[model samples]
Target: MFYFSVSMREVAFIKQNKEKWLNFEKTIYNNQFKNPDELSSLYIHLMNDLAYAQTYYPKSKTISYLNQLASAAFQRIYRTKREKTNRFISFWKTEVPLIVYQFRRYVLYSFLIFGLFVTIGAVSAAYDDSFVRLILGDGYVNTTLENIEKGDPVAIYKSGSNWGSFIGITLNNLYVGLLSFIYGVFGGFGTGYILMHNGIMVGAFQYFFHDQGVLWESVRGIWIHGAMEIFAIVIEGAAGLLLGASILFPKTYSRMASFKMGLKNGIKILISTFPFTFAAGFLEGFVTRYSNIMPNWLSVGIILITLSMISFYYLIYPHIVHRKLKTHVSTL
Candidate 1:
């Protein structure tokens, strides 16, 4: 009867905490806790229960169940701690690249659209003498023409102090990027309009300098920052296109759900281009102003390096990261 009473005690202990154990299991599996501190507190409580079970119910199946529960909680706590420490690094290295890879088609579409408009702008400028002025505004055209006559077609960039130029240009570029992303709400037509506006302006601006017999000079100076600046704009355009596509093609998800997903991912892509945008503005303000004095090789090198860096991040790095993840999952 003493042995029977001990067994009954163990059963009573299991019965008492059965619901609590189930709750802990659910929380662990679903990651439903509000914070790590809460999870840790629950883990500590579970450990105490586990110790009690081990001491008094050493021969019971209750011991096995409590041991498994404690083990799972410990693993979860360790994983949570590790992830918290590495979250920032993981966001850039894995999260953004994966999103870019998933939406690569949008990136291609953006490039095609922007490139087509640029071609149209160039062709229009070639045929019509007033087309450049019409697209770039008469004020800008006159100022540029005056600068060209003074043997510095890009002299407008040299107007402001380096720090002032950097801040102003950076803010303007960020505004353009934000507009490119936010305009996707109009089924992407608004984004297309923005892209067309910018693409045409760029083509016409370059053509104007080319028409003045300073094409190479303009190329040397303009491309110093334009490489990264234009590329970032194109990527932001891709994010906008992705946003529009999500609404137009919801597939298995409800339209609202799809929109939410698209907005989240599109914003992530847009955020990724910010560093490149800032670099472009910095180059435009501080470096491009000195393009006239810098050696042709130096200008070309800067352009190449900036283009390569941004290009690799958006275009090439995505594929590499995707492949690495695929291989890791396969091995697992």
Candidate 2:
């Protein structure tokens, strides 16, 4: 039997493939690949070489050089491969829902907190006449009171041109949603505060209309947009709380790593709410203005449809997608 020392084998391995390795490195650095197949072929060959090097000459500098070359080739091949799905469509269909499902507890918590604050606002307003004014601000309360007397309680929606109102309302809602997500850095208390403030205002505002004997009318108008608008806000609050929780409790990861993960996932959830927010603004600006003149059935239908659409997307659809994916993964 022939005997070959490890050092001789390592030197012979380097000598045999040194030119090919150098050429591959040049091809990668210069972006000189002819096509995806060529790049993939190079990557495969390099990986095989890497496996051989790792097994035999694990302590050699040749291993480091080949490893670097393999990494670069792999990155290039990965970047060049065509995506199998439309990224934008996939983001909405798979990515957002999965993230929402993963952190679903936060969503439930957000809804409960907001609901509790809303109840407090309604109860306080019921007991104290000044509570509405105190929460809603004197100017808004006075204007709404006058609008109530005029028998067009939601006339505020009719003030601006459709485009102007749509743009302004959309911008404001986006701002609020963003603030809710950003405030999560304060360990989620900031997000809770935003939800509380919005919930209280909504509760007080609704109670005021109820007290004035136009509860149904206000519901018809406000909820035309409020259904989607308020739901989106609650989801945004959840994203914020998720962010805070990531920092407060970095389970297996370091705090910074956990924060990055949380922020990425939280941002996805927040971005998912944008379409609903815009839809809400459109309804508020264009559709809501006609609440008084539009038939009750039509207004009610709009409210139900908008509410159902948003509710299905955020709440029900996530579970469906998650279950389907989980089942498919298990089968595989």
- Please report, in order, the local distance difference test score of every candidate based on alpha carbons: 0.82, 0.85
| CA-only RMSD, every prediction | 14.4, 12.2
Residue 34 accuracy (lDDT) in model 2: 88
Candidate 2 — worst ten consecutive residues by lDDT sum?
Answer: 323-332
Q: Report the backbone clash tally of model 2.
A: 0
Cα lDDT tens digits, model 1, 1-332, are 01123477777876777778778877875788877667777777777788898888777656655665554454455445445547667778767887788788889999998998888888899999989988988888899889999999888889889999899999999999999999998788888988999998888788788889999999999899999999999999999998997788765346886798789889999999999999999999899999999999999999999999999999999888767654433332
How badly does each model clash, as a count of residue pairs?
Answer: 0, 0
Candidate 2 stretches greater than 4 Å from native: 1-84
| Model 1 pairs whose backbones collide | none
Model 2, span 1-332: residue lDDT tens: 11223498887887787777767877886799988778767766777788899999887666656755654454455446565878788789777887787788999999999999999889999999999999988988888889988999998779979999999999999999999999999999999999999999888889998999999999999899999999999999999999999999775346996799789889999999999999999999889999999999999999999999999999999888766654433332
TM-score of each: 0.75, 0.75
Model 1 stretches with alpha carbons more than 4 Å out: 1-85
